[model samples]
Target: MTVPHRLSRRTFVGGALLGASALTGCSTVSRSTDVAAINKPAELPVYRRWKGAEPDLPTVNPLVPDAYLRYPRTTERAYSRKPGDGSEVKGSVAINTPIPPPPDRNRYWQELNARTNLNLGLTITPHADHTDKFQTQVAGDALGDIWTIPDRTPYLPQLLEAKAQDLTPYLSGRAILKYPFLASIPTDSWRGCVFSGRIFALPVPRGALSALALLVRADLFRERGVDPEFSTVDELMSVARSMSDDRNNRWAFASVPTSILCTMMGISNDWAEHGGKLTYFKETEEWLEVLDISRRMVREKLAHPDGITSYNGKAWFQSGAVSMMQDTYSALAGLYQQAKGDFEIGLPIVPGPDGAPAKPWYLNPNNAITGVSRAAPERIEMLLDFLNWCSAPIGTDEYTFRKYGIEGIHHTVKDGDPRMTAVGNSETGLGDFPIQYLTESPKPLYLPGFPDGTKEMYRNLKAVTPGMKPGPVHGLYSPTSSKKGELLGKFIDDTTNDVLLGRAKVSAWPETVRRWRRRGGDAMRAEYEQALEVKAG
Candidate 1:
């Protein structure tokens, strides 16, 4: 089915309004660009001009606004009636599934559909295995109007380049800014969606404070009289050595492979600055010191003997065998819920060789940007409207009921906090309800069964976590990501992993850098440079 490329100006204008609504009330605005016009309320005359198919103006002014300029309404119409009843506004939408919904049945898709005003029929696809599925569908012209393409996949750049609707107009204005919680999304998350100054995706902003941290057993630390707050790597190692008793079926700290360790230590594979260059980790002594310390930790037996074999680091922490491991803060809630004893989980800011706290690794800001398919243009407005609604803060009672389910059915409020009880269970043994995944409001610090002081413990952990220095690859989004950059990405990942794991020595890093440059890295750099040039213009 060869889809016709209409290139209709109205479609482009309408899509622009929809995209703009998604970002309207978001918290962080990009200072890098001039978005003044987008920050204001929609002028009514402009709305009248762009309203559906009727041109009120005699001639289209290049600068004049249209009906598409109206404040975006919520798209919750789909949830107004039962699925397949067709009582709501009757537009069909294709979306990616299994779709995430509020745990409560009453407010789930019903709220989503009512806000978006569309019947969203989802096409089930896994994020990991969707590349070929997406390609085949797009090539066949069988794509849904709204689908989520994973940010991690290689196919995103290509999809955007192939005439996908540019969402820049929609995202730039007051329509999106009206929703207060929607305003909280960070601009960095939207950077990946911008190409040639046009936006194509609605970014799902991961919170700014995300970072990898060490999770340790509070029970074990208390028993051993260890303070659990080590000022230096040496102090941490000292505790690990004393606590590790692998012979008695205990290990002080579970060993993480080199790549994660290096990231925790802040060793980026490449660094760029001043719009001119790229540098490798081999050029820095800090990189070598991090590796040397890690190798010694393994040799000294402070880490698990089978550390290399223990790939599931979370499971190690969960089983109570490995007392300490590193992971993101998102894991904190689950780990606290699952651990048997009253244990505290703390995030020690990774320490440098000088025993001073080092900067935590900052992930690429665009980590969670999402794209909608071009197959269904009408669906775009609905999708963005629903997203904006979801980003709003819920009342405390509403938040608990929506996230945990009814008080007696799925959970019980104990001591003024909701506790997980009987209702549903999955293969993971815990119920499928996810209280922590809500992006609308900042997650509450309380959870049932955690020690009374756990909230304070988390506050203290965050207080100690170090700030991030700008990444070497900061502000660089690859435009050549269209060409051979996919191969280059794989090489970088593979070579970096090899060097970190000690499978390839530090001496091999320079050659690895050269190999990467030879295999499209240089070209990709050039592409980004060009993009920056255009953006500057």
Candidate 2:
């Protein structure tokens, strides 16, 4: 989904007025600091070349008018083929629907086609079996004119390189600038779609430092006389111990083995270098400190008893068997609705040992990039036209509401603001649907409903956490390093799991590090270094 970018005063003022007007009595103009003034724009030292080695856009003053914000009407652009033609200009798409089997092929296709002015040929596949199915389709050249590929598939780079077309020419200059919200998308996420100086894929943009926040039961905290805002791991552990109930088999916290612990420990799966020299995350005191803290969490029993196993922390938390846990923003939404009034959910920033706020390690890449297939060159104009339409605010709103729900029906406007109606104990079937892959649509921001405290909570969390920096390994994409890459991932996972489970002592971490080096970590580093040199040259 699209993220909010650093807004110019003019833009913000205009947007505020619009929001205020929409809400009748609500004051849209909230006091906000100039983001640019408070946070320096990150400097991307590495030069990135678009298709045809195009130069970068001129740096715009955050306060000045950006010409790109101006979007043209649909009729202004030339269509590749006239409407109603039987050629490849068909408005519909064939997508692999993410749902369980016993697929309703006819009704599914009919609903999609009837809903929009398009046709749909859906291939229903379970999310669990999606990767293999997607890979098979790609290998068999069975991909439709427009289709979605899963984000977690390891073959993503290959699919982009070999199957997807360079969409840079379609999105550059006027095309890219047409979407005002596009600026909110981080540059690093855009860079993820670039390969060998060509943009081949469109990404689903996410926040730079989006991470799971620890959702604590506020009433429990108040009763225990503990401050809701615990600033250090030690403080969190103390609360966990105090709140825990082993006799009743309730946990103070249910732990899920997420990369979060490793991320906090500064263990990045993606590492980079420049000019044959390893750059960031390879050796940092902060990284080591994070790891040490994680080890303690497990050893001290503050984490769940089944933390090592793949426990469903969300289920546990919702069932009142656990009082604290970490999860993504979406997870928080689900829990908030499920636990409404019974318990007050509060968000806390991940903290460092010194009890200061620290940014959690995150990998918010732009997923679901829209692109044309090379086999269909003539469809480029049509594809661009569709994308242009999708990028507009109206289109984004429609897509988002469809995915989430419509206001006042599935949701409602509360206190002159838009918010979802509680889905608690309902049979709405809203949660059963999977609407994201309905088409190759533009991404929208995952905003919490207005007038709700959730958005405010997110804002406060963001303010406290340290902002993210571009990883040293930002734009290093080379296929040759695939084998070593797999090995490195295994090495890290094994060592980290062992340490957390107490199978391996924390003191043996240095030995594990040495083993990683011995088992191709050094070679992988060298390969990345060489790739960086080539890019610089």
Candidate 3:
């Protein structure tokens, strides 16, 4: 399945995520955020790993997912009974994959309903169309029994506070331990669900798995005799220059490596967190330096000559037109498949200017979060049970069924691993119907029939996650950010792009940033800083 952009601010925490202990110590220094008047850490779910199939490989970093070389031949029953109420359940969720076969004609859908004892119906919104669909519904107050809330929706915190159920009473602390699969989700992931001091949704955990990484061509590095171990930005750029050849119409980058450059420069993940204060990255001198470096890369032909216009960076990376591109760790599977033995991919950690291990900006630790609209306690409980059942981890009969579909009809084991059958390719899959977006287990480092890729991904995550940091303002509400939303966001984005593309002088940045601050950036910063001061637990 296609992944949404990793660095996009659009990736969101649940409207309100976590108690004090829920968020891991990253850039944010707000344990008090989870205290009473803000939230209660005791209200959060206790983390308990699901006892499932043993992994063939080890994951030292807790953020890195366990890797499996072979699919578990057997699955244990996670629950003894169906989670649904034998009644129709309707919901809406966004999908990045192609629309799957509809429930009426799909065997997998028919079986899922029978197994769950619910007539499940969902209006699947394509990622491209989701914003409009979600907003239209939100405006009309017509949210279904369940829905996936977009991170960028206008006044998200208010909408959730007004229309969504407070999941804290159900999922908080030891209370969550009853839902084995939900408890299995890392506690930090639940931090994304906290809004206004209460849990409002169930997060879709991606954690460090979704962090953006620099994908370099290892074969080319060896062939060109370029050293792959560089600890500073200048050293890395030297290598980039050595790897590029304008005369041959080749560059070291497919597109402007903005995200990678920002990481290397130690720019904070949107907002920099310091002693009881939060500073937006746009207000910093370091971000401007990154913009200048990006512009220089364009002028020196280190990046593609098209000047950052819409172009396929992955296509360039695959075709050898570019030696490096930035993508999430999840991209390796597709890259390996497309390469067809043509190249070896490398995951190199970029170091900061001071040679410190640069902190990669972690996505919200979740994608969209699933929220339940106001409903009877029984209906809500049933929905939660259904979600917890959906979270059945790898090596459970439910995970196997929901993730891959029925064995013979959808997938088959071949050469010691599961492979999708031709029928599985067209009639069923997550891209076609994104039930997983509602809530699924944290993804394992598993790619059917690509064991090496799985191993490599694990190594990659291990290499970088120790230095990764999350955006401090992620779950904190900023009324200015919500009210103005992307309208105000577009101004800053356009200004930043103009400077990066060399259309505007680097000196213009200060004025542009000032304009941003004057418009709403300053207010957002104030709001977030205030949020950090409030206690949660």
Candidate 4:
């Protein structure tokens, strides 16, 4: 629904911690409540995998992506007809990477335009600046042909209704089969593109690849004869305590992992559905218990004192100052790339308290989506077709070219793997540009040279499928939430931190939550409930 502006590209790969209420978005000028329905597309675009090389590993859930260890030697094209109308396609995207060389100096950029048969006139904005950039454009109704947003706006449904294309007619049900690659996107992901009971965006699917997790330094844990496996939260805490050695300047965690702790204790990620009504997670008993649990951990000195302040969790994890930190599953590749030969990364399962099964929160099927501004029907078709061509799956020539570029020019092949050369990394800026956010294929459990890590990633992904839980409010829009959600979210997060570090007592959290409810939380619940009711009817 929305991308967090503060997260790095690595964080985006795994999933950004966009807080709880950052769901659907649109405009500032309020419109009538005619755009009130909350249902997703009725008949989703049916999934049909592109014919490609078979995955080396067995597929997990159909929801989980197939895994590949080696690149396909031979590839086929997905489009018989060219996507472009032999004209320029104007677009923009936000990135955490450095500004890349433009098409004139960047051969990779030039080739993409040439192959797609469209000259791309694009504007790139740093993620920090993207919120303002997008808002300015949205407010002006000047969004280019293609644009991806940074955060949920107050009136996303109204925004689209007024300025963006209504995609329901084009993408709903079997209508999308015309664009094979776009239709290949799973049904759950297609749901994210819906707002006001209509489709308004194209998904950038990540599936469960972005599930939040606790990462432990397996090499260190192994040295102490402790496997990072536990059947109970108590067992995990015991190990965390043993790993903390004040004299050695090592702690158990980089920070208090609220999401993991909440999962372990059975706290819902957003509103917990009750019959037909909804209750905000902060108002629940589980939240109170998790607050106490987190406070206890903080008091035990199991985390860095600076964890919430100036500390850099990634730097500390790399230096072994902390044995564990919370992150997304997609971080596995970067960890492998960094560990090299020094240490191994472990995904420690956060089992329930006293060994009850934990229903860990999973990310929405898509991280963020690309929306199109209003355009003539034919021009819109051209843009959609171009995105379809761009969305080619991993085993195709278009995919290979966009990701790694030509063998000698941008990358080198070694030991059955494609390696990006320095020139490729520099000119393409694949790691930095966040191009995938614009349009992407189903994610693969992939690590180019580290096939072993690829296998491990697959194993962990398959292992977590049974208990993964998605948010109830994923595709629904909440006017009060979008209007004041950020402010209220900050209030709760800051209060939680205060309690965790002894600045506020656990006894005060209920009162803090009560204040939150009055300030907008309660209003949000009513809005969501009303929307849900309208949808059901």
Candidate 5:
């Protein structure tokens, strides 16, 4: 249920402002004129203390998580053997869901290859064209000893010093005390799999509430009486023009909410800092007031002209045409299991304007990382023993058959939790063929039997985590933002979607922030302000 982090396919085709400029080019950077980053800030690794399972709420704040309300009646198997060595591994990832059941007619991939004797294979792919098939398999080095290194990969420390696998001599410092579930991760998610200083990839933790938001539908805003709270931006454009109609085709917005109007104009998630200097949210002014409020949500039609060429705005908000959109609050529990809950999706209240101060945009703890292929380097201890049985934890048994795959043929438990059986939803694709993409265990917010939809998505991400901000070069590393920051973020998302569809103007946003600071956002803010003064010495 909520230990998913399964967000790839550029977390829904790079929306939320192109995934906040690919998390500000994977956590801020420096030393450009041809890449250079790790001159410090790598000495991280040091987590390895196990003994897990005890949840039902008690994680308090490592930035809020541990919530679970069911499932864990009694379990405890952190690894007594079974990591693979019976030969035949192979991998690939990328997912985005819907394509499971293959590993040779998957019976949870043949009971996780006979409980780790091995013979896996995989390949997966499809996260909306997995970065052109992961850059044609990392430019033909043909990766696959375990893959998925996406953090908007481009030059990523010269593709981890040429095709991954440095894993700092088997998980650095105390050599990760011999893989007790990849040393139970959590050393601040191994600083996003460190690069220039070495650990070359493993983490995927991620948090600080980022499964993007805005969602809404709240039973059609309480049956159109409207007023699901608003405070400005002209009262949410007068509640999206009284929930627009477009001659009854319905269109209260299926896009152009541009990450909730850049959190109602507080905008600062991709590099924020003030007195000490650092700017970058497209050289802010609340990003030119969210490009003049996305050209007034497309000249007041209140959006949804296929929301500027759709890529599943939750299928135009589940065919009601559009009551609102801005996704990934973990695809709201499979769109509430394809609306068996008939309505109510939620996440509004992002208003702000009168006294101004809404903000919301903090995510970037670690998501998407799993390397290990530098041409096999002697299969790095069988890919760290299959990533220590895919970092088990979360009430184990190899995380309940690598995440719900065979109990009465792929899930059934019921009151003690489990669920997913309609032939395990036509065979393993819920949250796309799990094993939590390559390696997991350190993300928790449970949703088992939907504890009130996990307390209304963690009380709406803890009422926007006290105006979240997070990103002053998040984990730092900016070889010109891993080489031309996604081609200068698709040239600033095709010139801000051509000035929000008026086909360009708003004085083309300060010359598109002066061509994204003369291309490379002013040498990635002078290489993240000297990697934030060597991370404050």
Candidate 6:
């Protein structure tokens, strides 16, 4: 898993807010974007005014994203015209995947620019360094016209009020019809983008209730005549021992499998609500149990020594150094890309804890949020138009070009599905320009040309969905969390890592939690609960 970047409290939000007091409260971080306003989830916009192609599969529950067996041929344009005013637009976003050529050199970018009649300059920062660069930009007041707010970026309300445009006038509720493509964005995703009870940003929608699973090298398991499924901890340990061969530098797994274990033990994603009261994972015994499991994995040498910090765990897994690993469901396609058919990857439903039923934890629907610079309020409509063009639904000309790129040049329609050619794979992978995460439409779950992988992933998700538990505070916000979350989180993370690696005693966990609560965790919970109460009314 990629380590999330930490937003420095002293520099990112606190400092910015302090320095921004001189600006008018209406547009700055004082009144319009106050803590109370920022923490409240916006009333969801009505899901009307969108007319687009339907999905091929069943999506009875809105939380479950529609799955696709193959890409459908588009019939109509989502928008009849472009939204640009023939001007230059600059955006800053992070990309950790395959790096694309510069905007000037990338053919796909050239085509998109020509189509929109705008010079869309994107400052694609390295993912690992994005937080630092974002902070530097904020400190220096060098923000671009459009920017992505990464999941863990601190003090979003302050940042928005001080720097980002209030999009309510252009996008609040039915006002979103000006960009039907954006209106097509799932309401749950839009709810997440709210600040101070107003729609402040364009969301990058992910599956609302997605979870991570333990993926195994099934080919290796089958070759070794080992059963991939285990009903108990001991059984799993036996399988781990069989898969590991330390003399040859191989290990049973790449990391401590605590995430899956947490789900199996019925742990909530972050908080659990009961009788309108909130409880955190840190306050539960299962959290300690997860720590025990991690420590045991290290003590038993079942995990790679560098598992926690290795930048290439997937490569290690592919090389057979480790046979089992954990990754998000959305990464199913990329895992196959890394394997290149060398091994058949399999996802086993995590067994229930101590023979009890399992409950998987879902990921937040969005990976990041994009905000328009407050400095360019006049250009809000144009910016929305650009995003709407990017968000053109699954079956439209804009979607086709954005998704597949010049059908013949980058991809070709085969059996009614767009397939990337060798040139496309070499020159234009989705990693080059991560528009999907930067500014996007709802993502359909499909892996083109890999029908078997797609089907297998669908089956896994279908099986896992029924047992999933949502994060209690998915769209709900907490001012305390936005301000002190990163700092308090570090305390918990450091303690967890130290205990798991045997550098500290597991008994030290309770005290760490105590410190966290004293510092800000309890306040965050209270704020969220209050927010939830207000929303309930």
State which candidate has the highest lDDT. Answer: 3
Best by TM-score: 4
User: How close to the true structure is residue 460 of candidate 5, measured as C-alpha lDDT?
Assistant: 67
Q: In every candidate, how many clashes are there? A: 37, 8, 23, 5, 3, 2
Once superposed on the true structure, which residue ranges of model 5 sit more than 4 Å away at CA? 1-83, 86-110, 113-115, 118-191, 205-211, 225-232, 237-262, 273-328, 334-340, 344-362, 365-379, 388-404, 411-419, 422-472, 477-528, 532-537
Q: Pick the winner on TM-score between candidates 2 and 3.
A: 3
- Each candidate's TM vs. the true structure? 0.68, 0.69, 0.88, 0.90, 0.34, 0.88
Cα lDDT of all candidates, in order? 0.46, 0.45, 0.73, 0.71, 0.67, 0.70
Better of 1 and 6 by lDDT: 6
Per-residue accuracy of model 5 over 258-284 as CA lDDT, tens digit each: 766766766656667775578866677
Q: What is the lDDT of candidate 5?
A: 0.67
- Model 4 misplaced regions, further than 4 Å: 1-43, 338-340, 353-357, 430-433, 467-469
Question: In model 1, what is the error at residue 163, expressed in angstroms?
Answer: 6.4
Q: Which runs in model 1 stand beyond 4 Å of their true positions?
A: 1-120, 124-143, 161-164, 257-276, 305-310, 352-356, 365-367, 374-379, 394-402, 424-475, 479-509, 520-537
Per-residue lDDT of 272-302 in model 3, one digit per residue for the tens? 8888687777678888877888877778888
RMSD of 1: 13.1
The TM-score between candidate 5 and the true structure equals 0.34
For candidate 1, report its TM-score. Answer: 0.68
The better candidate by lDDT, 2 or 6, is: 6
Error of 2 at 78 (Å): 18
lDDT for model 1 comes to 0.46
- Writing each residue's lDDT as its tens digit, candidate 4 over 206-231 gives 77776677888888898888767777
Q: Which residue pairs clash in candidate 6?
A: 37-196, 38-196
